[model samples]
Target: MTANENNTNGYLVGTTLERMLKAGHFAVTGELGSPQSAHGEEIRAKAALLKGYADGVNLTDNQTAIVRISSIAAGAILVQEGLEPIIQMTCRDRNRLAIQADLLGAYALGMRNLLCLTGDHQIFGNHPTAKHVFDIDSIQLVQMVADMRDKKVFQCGDEFKGIEPRFFVGAASAPLADPLDFRPYRLAKKINAGANFIQTQLVYDVPAFAKFMEKVREMGLHEKTSILVGVGPLKSAGMARYMKNNVPGIDVPDEIIDRMTAAGKGEPWFGKKNAEMTKEEKRARSKARREEGIQVCIDLIKELREIEGVAGVHIMAIEWEKAVKPIVEGAGLYPRPSV
Candidate 1:
């Protein structure tokens, strides 16, 4: 079906992310983190850097539960800048009322894509004393949004007078997370919940992710929804090890660490023997490792695109915006679709 049949907005009817995916394009999306300060210019500046490289940019919703500008406002700004935005919404801070209200506002702001997340707990954020209100989970949120678009009613079954918001709903996935066997089933549930697309958590273990995809294919979930594998640059051996050890739902293999370490060998602060090296030396090594990381990401994207049921790659160069262009170009996904 064409995008127009699924949306009412004139500006977003047939030329947004929804259409791109429906047309079977190899879509590329990037994540944009809002600055802590309320400077709109910074947000625009960062988005400008990704203008041509990414098909759409994900405006994080207080990512990690840290307070920042609203994803709705950021998405509006991105729309004004001639960029498509995937406004992210989480259930950590808002109740059902607030979530529905913001969904309406986001659609009014010309946003065509929405990503529903359950969000990290408040304890993980800077404010440990804050309370959370997860009135609904991500799956429910996806269903609610879909209902608003398709059924023309709210979760309470209240009908609207005018136009209902038309959104291409999306959700998150962690293929390598614990209870690996259940991950594909969870994906099926999300699809049943109205998730049209899914972007997975960062993947560093290729074989494990491949196994997960095998299950995904086995269930034929990929035929129902588009799957975008998440890939990012590692920066350094220190960073790779930190994600593997500290980050939840992330699995980084030792070989990647070894590659990063080996890439930084020419630097004076290559190994533990140089632990006492000056800050400048360490920075130099980190820079070298980042280059290697970019190449690694490029290779991963190439491999992921070859896999069955994989629609595209989501390059999340978190805080490393400048690296996105190179990574996309290197992966040969540049000159992105005009739509």
Candidate 2:
């Protein structure tokens, strides 16, 4: 009579990373950016490529309000490929009934992890013509999931004849958003709403993040919740600039920009130029970037982990999936768990 017995085949419910957080270990997770169109082959190829390197793949649901293949479809593909799938549930495109149906479908298909998001505005993405349904924000979505689990019923008023879902519920956070002082309050709200863990927007200011973690500890949330500091690899100077100037809800300090600028000016270490360098040079710089990224990553992870109540790390490499294993290894995380 375990709480998880209701889950589909007792597969690890909740995100693999969240399960790890609950178990008291630093966990690693990644995202699988869906293809722009119905290109299933391309999507499957991408997920297959990331299988061994990531503990779970978060299939974005119209991420940034961008219209793309559905997250459920992508989640199904990831599950079939032997990788854990985190079904990214956004309230932008569906009403409560649709949400319930989708969640049930995902569980039946073997998806366990759920990352609920409030979703981006439609105007920000390519699909301006699409209608949005933010009928429920992320907090309510978390509550809804909890209710379904505890009640063994769907929002659609249907009773389940079989197992209930044991979802490792997760929610998003942007530590740098709005008045800095208000972040802790927002986090408290999400936690109150049943968010088991959080994955933050890409963070650049380690000291600022450290301060935030301190506040989390003071609030006594450090041990009660798991916080994963998101990290995006800078593919080049331009990519770095784009993230700073264009990406919403991310703050990259002038110092980090200065470092990348300085690095850009230095001679290509190992006689490499741009992306066309020999495989060995490419490997070396990739290693060096991952090392550099991991150094910053480890610093934050160490500080974040030391926070009296903080649990594990979730490393997000974006399109640089190849670098994830190295970065995690570089950060000294061995035997990366499959779940």
Candidate 3:
């Protein structure tokens, strides 16, 4: 389908990310953190950094429960900036009525992609005392969005008077997450609920991820929805180790940690801790770790590309937008394909 093509029939998702996946282009997507204020320029500045590096940029919805600019509004800003934004919606705060209302507004603003999420609890955000309103879960949200687009009706079964939003709906996955044996089944549930694509949590252990993909292939979930493996540059050896030890479902390998530690070794003030380093030394040290992180991410993408059931890579450098370009280019996914 042409980029500008619009059809009421829903056969064509028509978003750049959808087109790339359809044409087997090995899509690249990135995360753009909406700032914690009503700043359109912040979104634009980040768009400039990511414009040519990704097929679609995801504008997170009050990520981490922190209040921020709405993801849909950020998506509109991105559209104005000549970049495609994937508006993210979470079930943590809104009811069905609010969710549908925002989606209608998002489509009117030229947003074409959506990622349904069960957002972080209010305890994780600034509003610890706020009430939780998970009127629906992520799976139900996907089904609702798909229904609005394809079935042309709201979750209440009310028909759209003129037009319903056409979104390439997506759902998140944590392949290595516990009840480890049930992850694939969970993915299947999302697909059965009408997710057009899947974006996963950050992946560090390629072999473990590949095993998860093996089950995905067996279940044929990959054929039903595009799977974008998540990747990101490690900021430091400590970060890598921390994730491996603390982050649930994230299994960071020893070799990667060793490599991250090695990347910082032999640098200026090698023996000095980051806290004790001079400002200039800290800068140099950070630059080295970031470079190594980018390389490691690139290598992961290459390995993932060769694996079955993997359609793309989702680069999640939320606060570190500058890393997106180098990571994409190094992975040979830059100069994003035109739909």
Name the best candidate (by lDDT).
3
Q: How good is model 2 by TM-score?
A: 0.84
Where in model 3 is the C-alpha error above 4 Å? 1-11, 274-276
Q: In model 2, which range of ten residues has the least summed lDDT? A: 3-12
> lDDT of all predictions, in order shown?
0.87, 0.73, 0.91
Best by TM-score: 3
Q: What does candidate 1's lDDT look like per residue over 62-149, in tens digits?
A: 8887888889999989999998898999999999999999888888778989989999898988888998999999999999998998
Show pairs that collide, candidate 2.
14-167, 14-168, 26-312, 222-309, 223-309
lDDT of 3 at 71: 94
Off by over 4 Å in 1: 1-15, 267-283
Off by over 4 Å in 2: 1-15, 156-161, 264-308, 337-339
Model 1 — which ten-residue stretch has the worst lDDT?
4-13
- Report residue 219 deviation for candidate 1 (angstroms): 0.9
- Candidate 1 vs. truth: CA RMSD? 2.9
Q: How would you order the candidates by lDDT, starting with the best?
A: 3, 1, 2
TM-score comparison, 1 vs 3, better candidate: 3
In the range 133-237, model 3's lDDT, one tens digit per residue, is 999999999999999888888999988877678899999999988999999999999999999999999999999999999999998999999999999899988
Better of 2 and 3 by lDDT: 3
